[model samples]
Target: MGRKHTPFTSLSRRKRRAKTLHIKNLIYRERDRLGGIFFDECDQVAALASGRWTWSDIIFLSQDPAIFWNAEIITANVAFADAVEDIAFNEAFSKLNAAETQQEMHLDFTPDVSSNGKRWLRKPALKYPQFDGLTFNDFIDKRALEIARDNPPAIYCGYRILPGYASGIGLQIVVEADRLNRAVIETAIADFRARGERNWISDVPARVCYSDKTICTPLKIKE
Candidate 1:
């Protein structure tokens, strides 16, 4: 006989789908807004480099109609970005807090990687006009550094196996985020689980053991 589907089961599945869709939409909206800001910043940097306008002049012109309109757009974009970040952080905090347990906690910290497959190692030490003298490549580095400052790495709490242990363990994994958001936590958990599975291949013994404390540690991702 085929298994029966209850009305409650159907409703639960629909709710899950709705929640997933909502999260995805939030991620997409955030990406779009941030991308827009990035391009706008890049353009502003380029213009500043060309000596088209000084920061002082730009500040003074803030009340000009054209400049004010541009400022309004950027302001709206920033507001949206802030709203999305708040939502993501609140959801992440609640989820992590709910997973708190009495197990020993291990720490994992890794450097942030860029889309170009390079590690962002430079610390954010320079400010606006300092960046004005930078080359295009250096400008990108400065931008990344500023982003790191704004979105300090997110630390995710979860359970995982320690490096040499055959048993599971609790861990606090620090993941670098271009933007501190819930997606970072989700990715960290998935990566941690994948590393645990890979390590298990070598740790197999005469008897397989499992424990509630067993959590997987993340393997370093190669640059």
Candidate 2:
């Protein structure tokens, strides 16, 4: 499985294009890299913020084992105030840390990602990746650690690991170890149907077995 790059109309600047996907400030117990939190509120920056956050602030969460994080991605309007945790899952990542683990994931806040490692968001990205497509009641049975053996698209976080060496603690994307193939196809269809974008798909080349069908994958992350 290898990548077949999808060429697009080159952009003059790579700014975050306007997104129709709503956002929210996911909220959950900061469980030492276990999962995410309740990222939905009215007074977002002021409600669940530990320090100062902004309407455009893109926060990062480091889950221990760097994988198997059970978090929620709430889709809100523009800011945390309008963000809504539309989906939640406890699964593996797809690309970033293809084959790695950490016991204690950490969380940091920074404005610049000068050193860590990352690229811009490319084509054929996942549209609405869910845990089990359970719709709040779908309990995950990742009892099987499966992942897509394909390399998905990625995006830069605009900041890097403050400590420098992000071995197991770097940026990543989460992909289910069990349903990667379908995931790939889903991505293509979504992009075309919703956004009128056509991109390529592949099984990928960066996946490593984490054991028992478990794949520590991410959503097109980098080191």
Best by the TM-score measure: 1
**Cα displacement (Å) at residue 127, model 1:** 44
lDDT of 1 by residue, 1-223 (tens): 9765433223344553454344344334444532311111223333334432211100001111121101101111222333344544443334323223111022333356654545555443322233465533355544444443465333222322323211111132333322222233345445644564222222211111111121122222221
Name the runs in model 2 displaced over 4 angstroms.
1-27, 30-157, 164-223
Return the number of clashes found in candidate 1.
11
TM-score, per-candidate, Cα-based: 0.19, 0.13
lDDT of 1: 0.30
Please list the C-alpha lDDT of all candidates, in the order they appear: 0.30, 0.24
RMSD of each: 25.6, 24.7
The residue-by-residue lDDT of candidate 2 on 1-223, one tens digit each, is 8765332112112311111011112323322232232121223323224222212212222222121111222111111111111111233332114222221132323443565535333222222233333311222223221221232222111112222221111211222222223233233223323432222222443232322111122222121
